[model samples]
Target: MVLEEAYVDNQHNNLENVAHEMDGLLQFNTDRMIFFRNGMQSALETPLDFMILRKAEQEYISKRHEAIWSVALHNRRTLPVYGVSDAFIDKDPTLSRDNTLSGNELMATLELGYLLRLTNNNRGFTERMLYVSRSGFFVSTESANKHHPGAGAL
Candidate 1:
């Protein structure tokens, strides 16, 4: 899912750091699951099947946060859902309409419980440091070495 108009949080201030934090929180070894993407631009490619938007400059933080959560909860789907935006801090009238339409589509196509399972239990598995792949999934260098010792040098 592409996180359009995503910006670095003032606290984090670095896209790479944010990505690392996300990986730390989301990677799972037991299930061999990982959420992977380079940065904001490439985040759209992640296979997790959902996208979350950062609060826009003009919007109320609480309201935007609640709205996003609501959309995720109500719109459940097997396929990934993406949250698109145009800027980090600007009036983008299109976001509400886009989210609404996407949410509806997701709700129609997915089961509510399935989406919840993915989101709520994201930390259920073991964590690993990973590298993002073109396919938008995380791959661990250590895991690769264990499986094929010589592969690291290739």
Candidate 2:
């Protein structure tokens, strides 16, 4: 099912219908799978040096992006959700020019995903492919967790 709107809300206090909707969106059960599949490549291609910066961005988004939307839950509470863009540029600033190359062509995206051991439920979080400009960066609403199901990495 497709989500008409996407927003994180406090789960515990939320009604059953609202909770069901949130689960669907977070689980990524929509037809937007193609966007996510492509987005994985884009996120992986992000430079290694910038990984820390990217992680910082992810961390920031997890903690503060939707401060008002989340609430405590029973088992843990609410899981973090990240929405990364489809394209990104080298944040080195020293690169001088932009690295707008496709991650598929360069294999940077795949490589990074492997190195980070990221999965759809882990490393780089996204719901759809975003068209990121040169300086564009991701703004996640959740944090990466150690709770991801361990089947594969990257």
Candidate 3:
């Protein structure tokens, strides 16, 4: 079935896809077949099907982040990348940069799921792919875990 609404079950809290990936799963039932038009390369190799689950749901912590990572090596053969860590932090909240917040604290209007690993490069273990379904803005929220001892631990 082509459902544009959120499909909820005891197993899942959010079943509605929040992003329209240039391509994403839409349908694949009985015959279990689905095809989508792509420019040149195909992102989906195997067919995916939804499940009618009835498992119990429990407390789970959710987290997402949108930040750019830049590293510069001394002649491409050094560590720490010399002061790159400073650049990794979000300085301008006016830039509407939301970095360190638990999922519940996040005012995200969309949900993004990613694999545990994306690729490997230059000591970079695994990256992630984020698909923002709708346009949204972020205002960085201060984390209390840094100030108080276990005030708000995720």
Candidate 4:
């Protein structure tokens, strides 16, 4: 509703924030995903399929929060995303078609770049935090470490 209003009103300011707020609250919300997964694990004998599906979802958030290490070090860079559906001007004609297109593209780039830089290396970021088990979809990190004493050590 608010997002549609933003576009309808040509109010691009903080549009990405609006999108994020909506996404954070509803569509990609993860508040009880872990809790439910834990419940499912306790309930079922064969939870691998559930875990696999949940793992993919967890990966979306975990990998986003992963440290970039070096943005340049990665051979495969995340491509910039353009999410704007239509021109903000809505064909007012004050700006040439090429200029409007350029402006829209630039706006898309700036917004997406801002989002990527923040999310790609932000750990424990509340805005898009992962509530998954520390060891991932299967078991608690404590249980994982109990089996090995130290799960990821030499």
lDDT of predicted model 2: 0.34
Cα deviation at 58, candidate 1, in Å, is 27
lDDT of 4 by residue, 1-154 (tens): 9989978767665676798798877644464455445444543543224343344334333333332100111212222221111242233344322432443333333223333343445443344322121121111112223434443331
Model 1 vs truth, CA RMSD:
22.4
Residue lDDT tens for model 1, 1-154? 2344343344456866889878876554423433221222232344334332222112322333331111222333222222222232125432333443443433332332233334444565334333322211122313234534453431
Off by over 4 Å in 1: 1-30, 34-90, 93-96, 99-103, 106-113, 118-154
Give the Å shift of residue 148 in candidate 4.
50
Using all chains and alpha carbons, the TM-scores for the candidates as numbered come to 0.20, 0.19, 0.16, 0.20
Candidate scoring better on lDDT of 2 and 3:
2
lDDT of 3 at 150: 48
lDDT of 3 by residue, 37-139 (tens): 2201132332111110000000111112322211211221111100111223345332332334322222121111111111112133224222221112221
Model 2, 65-138: lDDT tens digits are 33122111112212222222222123344222223442222233323333223333443345422221232322
Where in model 3 is the C-alpha error above 4 Å?
A: 1-45, 52-117, 120-128, 135-154
Of the candidates numbered 3 and 4, which has the greater TM-score value?
A: 4
Q: Which ten residues in a row have the lowest lDDT in candidate 3?
A: 52-61
